[model samples]
Target chain A: MTGLVSLFRRLEGPQTLGRGPAFWALFALVLAGALAYPLFSDGYTVGNTVYFFVWVFIALSLSLIWGYGGSLSFGQTAFFGIAGYGYGILTINFGAAYGFTWIALLLAIGMAALVAALLGYFMFFGRIAGVFLGIVTLAVTLMLERFMAQTAGPEWRIGAARLNGFNGMSAMPPLTIPWFGGPIPLFADVGLYYVVLAMLVLVYLGLRILMNSSFGNVIVAIRENPERAEMLGYDIRKYQLITFVIGAALAGLSGVLYTVWGQYITPSSMGMTAASLPLIWVAVGGRSDLTATVIGTLVVLSGFQALTIYGSQYALVFMGVLLVLTVLIAPNGLVLGVIKGITKLVTRRKQEAA
Target chain B: MALLQLRDVNKHFGGLHVTNSVNLVLEQGEIHCLIGPNGAGKSTLFRLILGEHHPGSGQIYFAGEDITTLKSFARIRRGLSVKFQVPGVFKGLSVRQNLEIALQSRLHGAALDKEIDRLLAFLNLEAEQAQLAGNLSHGQKQWLEIGMAIALKPRLLLLDEPTAGMSPEETHMTGEMVRRLNAAGMTVLAIEHDMAFVRQVAQRVTVLHLGQVFAQGSIDEIVADERVAAIYLGQAHA
Candidate 1:
């Protein structure tokens, strides 16, 4: 019972914003509204909203890696591609009977994490930092994209699944759960939407608890001053690698979801443009805080989609301009800055009233 | 037995010999100070002890165990700690958070919170416990850094210029802080430039010149030595 209390209390840690009874009430109200969203919306609209939620995992992954752990990685898309392809190959080969699809999902995510661990070992142990680390990660990402783009040959087939190269892979099974009555498919509809939303809320609260815990404190300390942290007796490389793997796994979840959403996985998903999009989403939201990253990613994604529908050529260009402005005007994060402003105003008003 | 022993330590950067055949010893629970002129390699020696830079030759023994090749974190886990030349406190974290991080390795639950409170009170930072360490005054940052180091309950503490950029009063308070740590059974090896601060804390002192130990004695004896005055202290006296 004390453990449960402490976990909930830790959600108000200083590393993140939003606390007190007012914040909790607002949080509960927002969640209730999200839960009721599909009831009033059409199927297509609800599915579109699910697309936005799917990308949050990737954005939050970047926020954890670059914002908190102090390593900017362009390789999130690489992990995404790896997991998406892994899932497509596994499900296409084994078939989804008896819900082997869930096992495939776990294995695909594990593959991404393993790759991340190996890459992180080399980069972190090699002592790569700052822009050099960014360069190395971008190089790895682009290298993977180039390799996958060339696998269009018949020799690229794995068992029954085909690596269709630039055209990408398709016909993978959607995620299914083994229920008592029968297996239920989550095909990017309201079912998948609810599952993804529940996962997001759990992940957000779980991360808050983690960042407020001792391990989380050490990760932030490493971000602040690695040498100082080392002198204080932390093996900073181990911590960095762990954070990297966790972030990569989250990116992998997005990959699997994206594949299930359209039943297709494409090489362009790992392309240069795709790799940079998550960075913009994270940076524009305020990379340090998870809540800011989630809100920022959803808002920017909705705006980008609207632009793509109305003025397709201007969509990417507008995103670029927004990223530049975020860097220039609100490098800490636009959403986070605005939230801080409101918080200050409320506190001041309370004091005056008192 | 000496708490820390460095024997025939040599380090070179290209042709320049930084720490040359240096030999030193610190008995447990003594406040020892290293003093020298600019480029005397005092800070370099501290780095060598902390394992940031390994010695070109010779060995470092802490608590009668060879720690010459252990990684810095490993050495720290073996009861060594450091407050670096610059204030290395986590600027993005709160003052209390900084101490909590330091204490977390050895404490948890209510014990961790209790230690954090004690450290904040000890550093005179209780009022600003929630303030960011970056927002602290220079003296407060230094104090917070000191609080962080002692929170480890280390057997040996290496402090490089603990009182740099401090007012005389703050410097004296730091001297008192070091003495208190020493009284609580920590062996201290500090590199300092302030003579008053040294006189207030150092029971024994070592003078280095040109990467060599030129003199070692009581603070008064070293102050009275003409050779020590000629090499390093004369400039300070001037």
Candidate 2:
């Protein structure tokens, strides 16, 4: 196992930290904590845990784009909201006979991926980059918010699903699996919590595998220097488009999961502020490191949630301060520093033993 | 036939004729050094061959095929690689990862461990395998970039100023490395400003003056040429 880890370290290298048995132990502990949460908590508290998992997915999506793929986007919510609407409308129109839950999820994921690919094709090939890329992505989010908000009339109905506009869709079909033992609703608080936790583990594992693959190496190389990568025979625009589409697909999936938990959809959730939430999470966590980004999202998000309970007005201020400190003190993310410190301690012990 | 041939290639940036009806050839298995003043179009000729900028007129042939219309990467895929004027190593990646990226550029998805092991050993960078490339010294980074350039395993390597900022020892080491690679049958085309370093590695010299080849001969012959000494002596000192 150590040999494999070292080989991967040599192949993928120092971009990742503490990616050995110690890291796996921490992962296992987190898994255990998530699995044990619902057993000790009420339905409402379990619901909050599920929400945290959803946000983790959103933050991971942003990290993949910005940290790994090296594209900063401010409109991930556009894809998220697209997936939400796709789920709501399709589930409503299809009804329970077919129980098209899986179909609805696919639709949502596809919708966002397609839109992102189109936007990426234009932006990357047109050579629109840096801050301009951020602006274009933000425009997409704002346009979605305004367009969805205006769909508040009788004429805005899609099949059985009514476009409630600013008032919002109060209910959607529950997440269900057509079990051989009959249908099982996955959205029952404890069940939904487990599903989200399992999905989080799967996504984390999948991303880890990808981050060490040749594809991941190429993407990181492109992020560092597009011209150099291009000169080395890589099609830079193709890879950029691929990264954008993957991020959008993940955000869309996160939106589907959010819709399942909240049992509703709202235009406000697709606004600029909502979109920026993932960016802040990624920034505070350490944008380039996956583990750091996840840790940052969880700790900072829970901190903000705790603040809101104490004094809602001060939560934003606290978040702002946290972001400022993260930027100034640990620009790589506080979690990265923690990982480095752990690595140092382990190496010191090994040297002493020798 | 030459390994690379440029026939009357001309390029212009609006009104500035950077490459004025330039004709050149690089024969196989030879060490060729290109030297000229800053605006003498030495680098522009490299770009024209790499397909970064297409000639306004004329043709580029590589290994005897017309490649004037090929894109930069397409040309690379045909077994050509370049070491840029600037250090082009990926700073965020480790030395090992950087080498892996380069090797993967030419050879894909197999036992690259053997090749990577060989490269690390050849460059004597095994101790810094896990070190982040950004932390490498300027000379180390230069060698690492050379490691990356050779990692492509190109039949022809275009090196743009391999000893620009190196000390005498480092420059001598670089010259040795270039000679070793050429000895092993890899054709090298180098652009150099350091005359001492050039004389160390030069087999033949091509001097460009104002977008055209002013003279081409063995190093001793060119150094003894009155016209060559007069045009370059002032700029070379400066």
Candidate 3:
């Protein structure tokens, strides 16, 4: 019981925003609204909203990697693409009977995490940091994209699945629960939406708990100053590697979900453009704060979708301009800055009343 | 056993020898100071001891164990801690959070909170615990870092220029804090420039010139040494 109380207390750590009774009340209200969203909306719009949520995992991963861990990585999309393709190959080859797709999902995520551990071990343990770390991650992302884009030959077959090259591998099975009355497919509809929603909530809260833990405090210390953290008896490389693997696994979760949603996996998901897009999503939303990243990701994704539909040529241009403006004006993040302003105002008013 | 022993340690950067065959030892329960002129490699020697930089040739032993190849964090885990020349505080974190990071490895729950409280009171930073370390005054930041090092409860504490940016009053207070820490069975090796602060705290002193140990004696004997006065004290005042 005391453990539970301490966990609740940790939810209000200084590294994140929105806490106390009011914040929880507001969070509950928002969650309730989301739970009730499909009741009022059409099926198509609800499915599209699931797409927006799918990308939030990637954004949150970047937030953890860059914002708190202080290591900029463009390799998240690589992990996403790896998991997506891994899911496709496994399901296409073995077939999704008896809910093997669930096991496959775990395996796919595991594959991405393994690759991340290998890559992160070299990068962090080798002591590559700052912009050089960025450069290395970008190189790895692009290298994977290029390698996957060329597997167009018949030799690219893995059991029953083909690497279809730039067209991507398609027609994979959706995630299924082994229900008593046969398997239930989560086809990006309201069912999948709820599952993804539950995941997001759990992940967000889990991150809050983790960020407030002793491990979390040490990482922030490393982010502030690696040498000082080392002198304080921390193996900074180990912490950084663990953080990177966690971020990669989350990205893998997104990849698996996205692939399951469309029943397709593509190399373009790990392309240079796709890799940089998450950076913008994370940076413009305030890279340091998870809440800001979530809000910013949803808002910007909606805006980008609208631009892509109406003014296709201007979509990338709009994103680039928005990124520039974010760096110039509210570098900490526009959403986070607004939240801080309101918090300060409320605190001052309460103080004055006292 | 001596708390720390460095034998024939040499470090070079290209052709320039930074630490030249430096041999030193610190007995347990002593407050020792390292004084040197510019480019005398005093800081470099500290780095070698901390294992931030390995010696080109030689051995470092701590508590009768050879730790020459041990990484900085490993050495630190064996009861070694340091307050760097710069105030290496987690500037973005609160002052209390800074100490929490230090004590979190071996402490938890109420014990963690209790230790944090003790450190805050020790540093006289109870009032500023909630303030961001970056926002603290220069002296406060230094004190907070000292508190962080002390939070580790190290057997050997290395303090590099602990009073670099402090006023005379603050420097005197720092000397008192160091003496207090030493009195509590903590051995300290401090690299300091202030003669007054050294006189106030140091029981023994070592003078380095051009990366070589020039003199080692009582503070008064070192102060009275014409050669140390000619090389270090004279150059410091210049």
Candidate 4:
């Protein structure tokens, strides 16, 4: 028994559980809640939970770049909006079926990846870092939103009597799983909830794998010190560009999932508000921990929804408060703080016992 | 032919001429020591050679190839590496991980682990391999940085104050290590303020004053030069 325990401990690395058990526990609980939602909650509540999951993916993507990769971006929503548009164009204009939609989604993700690569190459290679990178991405988001609004015009407006300007796109087709059943109506909240939940799990696992890879170590090294990473023979610019593209592609994937669930896509998705939300999610969640990012997204999104009962305006105020409090009290994020607190308490108890 | 050559290298930071038309050549297996007072542009000249700073004019030839315009990583790829004045290691990573990254860059794939193990053994860092780099003492960090520089088996290594902030014992150990490296066919260009340490290791020495080479010869000859002693060694009568 002792040998087995020691083997497990060695595999997990020293300080692994101490640094992150609370975070892991919290993630597991949230995942359990996600799994239980479809069965326990009413259709409307289930639908909202599905919406939260989509944003969780977006938040995770943002955390990967801003938190781990140490590249702040405000143009994530550009990729999100582009993916939605790709889905819309494929289903509505190109008459693509389920199989082709999947292909189109991949292609859309590729397009977003390309955009991210190009932008990162220009920005990072030119040695523009920190605030300048943020400003550039913010400008790109604003430009894309304006361009989309202009090109979308009045005629191709989504729903009748709604220019999709303020009301947004509608009647997006439902995703079908041929093996399980025919078309699963995304309007069926349970179906969408499961789909989003499954995607979130897959994405989290994929990102976990990525973060553990040697390439990911290089990214972390770059984040710690770009000059040191360069001296170690890493082409910092190439790694930065690759990270940007991967993060953007993930954001685009989340966008596709969001459009399918919401049955709509809007120019607003490319706006500053949408772009900023994911960054806030990263801030609320510990930037270094993906599980914390998901938790932060769920908490913030739930708070926003709950506040909406009072008034829509209060949501932004709540977010502002959360941001300020998290930054001041727990700059590493609430999850990290809680984990550290727990570890300290445990160690204190151990010392007392000794 | 020299392993590394800088011909009339000039670097100007706006109005200040940091490296003013300096020429230097380092032969293979040579321990070339650069000594200068503070602000004598020794660090600046090192940066210029490592491609961290572009020379305003003139050329840097490495193994007969002009590498003046190459980027830092490109120069590193061409078997040129540098250890900074301040020990530069990834603080978040473990000692072994730091060495692993360097080894990976040099060898990649299957050979990475074996190479890293060899380097760990060479540096006597196998015991502290799992320790975070940030936890390492200043001297240890310096040794780790040197270990990383040699991980790629670079033909020419530029070390900027390798013994700075080290204990006497650590300094002696580092000097011995540098000698071993030089004897085993690595060309080294080192900057040092400690004349005693330099004398113990460097076969040839160049003393810099202002931004130009003040004197260059065998250590004994340069030490004995009256002009060098008067101007650089701060002796009124030499």
DockQ of each model vs. true complex: 0.92, 0.75, 0.91, 0.64
Local lDDT at B29 for model 2: 89
Per DockQ, the best of the predicted structures is 1
Name the Cα RMSD for model 4.
4.5
lDDT of 3 by residue, B199-229 (tens): 9999999999888898999999998888888
Query: DockQ (C-alpha) of model 2?
Result: 0.75
Q: Kindly list the per-residue Cα lDDT of model 1 for residues B84-121, writing each as its tens digit.
A: 88999999999989999999989988899998998898
Worst 10 residues of 2 chain B by lDDT: B229-238
Q: Give me the chain B TM-score of candidate 4.
A: 0.94
> Which residue pairs show backbone clashes in model 3?
none
Point to the candidate with the largest lDDT: 3
Error of 3 at A173 (Å): 0.4
For every model shown, the clashing-pair count is 0, 0, 0, 0
lDDT of 3 by residue, A124-179 (tens): 98999999999998999999999999999889999999998888999999998889
Give all candidates' CA lDDT scores: 0.92, 0.85, 0.93, 0.80
lDDT of 1 by residue, A1-354 (tens): 998998888898878888889989999999999999999998888987899998999999999899988889999999999999999999999988788988998899999999999999999999998899899989888999899899999999999999989999999989888788988988878998998899899988988888888888998999899999999999999999999999999999999989988899989999899999999999999999988999999999999998999887799999999999999999988998888899999999999999
Any idea what lDDT model 2 has?
0.85
Deviating ranges (above 4 Å) for candidate 4: A1-37, A96-98, A150-152, A155-167, A178-185, A343-354, B107-131, B233-238
